[model samples]
Target: MWYNIDFYIWAVNLLVIRLRKPKMIAFVKSLVTPIVNIHYDFLQKKAIDEFILNHNGQVCYLRKALNDVFDNELRRIRIGSGNQYNRQYIYTRAEQKPVYLGKIYIRDKSAFADTGIDYIVYVPKKILASRELELIKWIEIFNEAGTAYKIIGE
Candidate 1:
């Protein structure tokens, strides 16, 4: 009787092991491993391509040049508001006052014009001259605008 009981227990364990799905384990491992390299690379490339398409490829070149100057400042700035409607940023100036900037709309009247888009940059009156100058320098370096300008609104 003891021998029969031991055999039954062993058979139950073997059955449970056999019933486990190998494909489920494989599916989970597949989701985790490629996430590091493959998914990240694809996302980075997609972002670059999208930026190029929206800004006529100027955003790519501008990003490199702007990084040299205002990369630190840019890091400090925060996107202020807007959902699917507009993109906005709020930056605290060197004097510790906040400025809000954003893109509004775009329209073209010329027949040959590319109705790309238009944008807006807003600066609060409380911002200091030094911070304003730094922001303007970045805008000039990037061939962008200050207080008001037009670009593709993404």
Candidate 2:
């Protein structure tokens, strides 16, 4: 009889342990989740920092990023004729003036030299009114070093 009771107690203990195992595992996972998230956030931040450092002052990258920023918007603005009905903006390349470099004069001066803005971005006045701040922030983030640009409402 005692042996039977001991066996029942052992079996019950084993059952309880088996049931508790999953709870223990879940508790451990809960504790680990925040740490994993912190590590992942740190790694993501580090990657962005590295990219900014390595991206340097490349105009091509800045231009491409700017184009992508507009394209990625939910409303899908485009670069084309700034028709009042169209959701679009126009980008004009820097106008360079002739500077004597060698046999031929190099066009180095921007057409509008009075302003520090190197590129002129014209947006539909209505769209610009609504999105000016947002567009300006994205432009600043992706601007090339020693280069500046202005966004005008057309």
* Regions of candidate 2 where Cα sits further than 4 Å from its true position: 1-20, 50-56, 73-113, 122-131, 144-146
What is the Cα-based lDDT of residue 46 in candidate 2? 78
| Candidate 1: C-alpha lDDT | 0.42
Identify the leading candidate in terms of lDDT. 2
What are the TM-scores, per candidate, against the unseen true structure?
Answer: 0.23, 0.46
What's the residue-level lDDT of 106 in candidate 2?
A: 38
Model 1, residue 128: what's the lDDT? 27
lDDT of 2 by residue, 17-94 (tens): 556566665665566666666766777887777655555334555544555545445433333321222122233456
State the lDDT of candidate 1 residue by residue for 16-116, as single tens digits: 46554666545544555654456567668877566444442244455444343344354322222111243333555775655644453542432112333
The lDDT of model 2 is 0.53
Q: Which whole-number lDDT from 0 to 100 does residue 110 have in model 2?
A: 36
